[model samples]
Target: MKLLAVDDARARILAEIAALPAETVPLARSIGRVLAEDVAAVRDQPPFAASAMDGWAVRSADCPGSLKIVGESAAGHGFEGRVGAGEAVRIFTGAAVPAGCDAIVIQEDATREGETVLVPAIAAGRSVRPAAGDFKAGAVLLTRGTRIDPWRLSLAASAGRAEVSVGGRARVALLSTGEEIVQAPATPGPFQIYDSGSPALAEMVESWGGTAVRARPVRDELDAVIAALRDADAELIVTVGGASVGDHDLVRAAAVVLGLSLRVESVNVRPGKPTFFGVLGDGRRLLGLPGNPASAFVCAEMFLKPILSAYQGAPTAPATMPARLAEALPANGSREHWMRAKLTYADGGVSVRPYRDQDSSLISVFAASDALMRRMPGAQAAEAGTVVEVLPLSRA
Candidate 1:
């Protein structure tokens, strides 16, 4: 089989992930969900010209003289009377500016004496928030595919939107194959290992805005693996371990039995070469990950994240930022490398130091790594302080 370049493999996988369907959800529960349509402002922000400071509202021309304080306005309660010439209304922050008031003198800038106050001159619009200032009615506050974070959701709510139409969450099924893969909470027998990858991948999926359901582990038999694959009903089915074509591997054999159309056979990347992706019968996507726990985690960070991020019609382009190397490294060979590394935030971007041991099965190393120091295929070696590229790894 031809070893696919890392970029080529990523492109192949990205090309196949179409956007999921949309749904309407309340604003309270819309965090991390992508918008299916533009969120338009239903009403004007501030709704009325309001005071932005706790002071007296008066016509700009009435400043520098004593003005009678007629009424007081506080948040949620408006002073209904108007501010006539030589008159001022005491107003709090976010309170509506009474009629005929054009400027607000902050409390610190005014000297109050019982029912009258002397204030300094201020510009016409000083400390006053005009109607439709933040966002006008019918304006698009959030565009399509905007991820509804806390701030965005707050903006939407303030714009009079009680609910929004958001893209459906991507449902992912995680399958951990091989008899050696026993799930946690159950002690493994001698020569058996816990199914650590599926749970970790599930948490990663949730963090990336996808829902993951882990199926029970299967023995290293083609028939058993095929049964599990048949039962998976999610949009994407991910199988951990037993993916390589080794004599003991059963994942690829099961996919073959299910007539999965292969888009990628192997990748030219260290620790993740055995990773593959394809479409099974019935249009569900399949991703075959290597057996090593850390290898599977790295591949998930490199591939699964991008796939899920693009499942809402907005394809997230892979990001690589420049970083200074904190430690020296050796030359890279034919396969591209994603060395587990730690990041020290610096002036511009970050400083990265690769872990000493890069073995595929080191889960502890992978856990401690916050960045992946990327090396292009056959790249030359470099010393400390050399600029390099890195991709952030999110285990949470």
Candidate 2:
């Protein structure tokens, strides 16, 4: 297989993958989800003209001068009396802007004297008086395809939407394939390794807003692999390890047997060149990530994240930022390098320094990385102070 550029590979992968359809979720359970339908205001916000302050709600025409204080309107309680010419009604914040009232004279701007208060030009030269539909009774507040964060949920709740229709969570089936792979926290024999990639990848799926339905290890036998994949019953199947040339690499053979059309076989990217993507005959998507933990993680971040985003109708883009190289970098024209690095702010912009060692098999390097410093194929050794594309792993 010929090695493809990173952008070209990514573009092709995204094009082949399909987004998951939308589904309705209760408002209480909608947070951290994505909206599939546009959310408009069901009713007027505040449901009535409301006071902006705790001061008296009086005719703006009479706010500049003192008038008799008739009754107090606190929040839920509204004044029944009409404010005749030269009269004012005291009102609190959020109280309905009463009839015949145009402005609120703040208590700080007025001096109280028994039943009457002295006030000065609170409404002069200002249209401070709020009108009906100040926030619009039925405005289209939130558009469709919105990611439902805490703030978005609050907005929907405030807009009187008790339930929201959101994009269905992507169902994921995670398989760890290898005869030598054992479930983690186990007393593994010297020949066996704990299955760290499955759990790690599962957490990654959950973090990307998908529900991980299966995280079990599958033996190297092709039948066992097929059975595991069949039992998963997920919209997307993520297989870790056993994707390479070894005899135990049954994921590729199984995918081919399952009638998955290969999308991209190889890419010119370090640590993840052998990553594979395909779609099953039944339309379920498949990703063949490298078995090495670091390689698997990098491939997951590069391919799986965008797939999940597209499934949820969320936008996905590589997080690129300008950063100066903190140290000299070696040139590798054979493959595009994805160097694990730490990014720090220096002199006015960010500076990225690659980790001392970046072997695909070393998970510790990946765990310590705060960013991925990308050097394109055929590029020269990056000199200190050279600007390059840095994908931030940690926002801070």
Please provide TM-scores, in order, for all candidate models, with all chains considered together. Answer: 0.92, 0.81
- In Å, residue 147's CA in model 1 sits off its true spot by 2.4
lDDT of 2: 0.79
Q: Which residue runs of candidate 2 sit more than 4 Å off their true CA positions?
A: 44-49, 58-67, 76-90, 105-114, 118-120, 124-135, 190-194, 313-315, 319-333, 341-356, 361-370, 383-387, 394-396
lDDT of model 1, residue 290: 90
Q: Looking at candidate 1, what is the lDDT of residue 146?
A: 85
Q: Please, what are the lDDT tens digits per residue for candidate 1 over residues 179-269?
A: 7878778999998988778888998888777889888888788788899998997999998988888888888778877789999999999
lDDT of 1 at 145: 83
**Global lDDT for candidate 1?**
0.88
Best candidate, TM-score: 1
Clashing pairs in 1: none
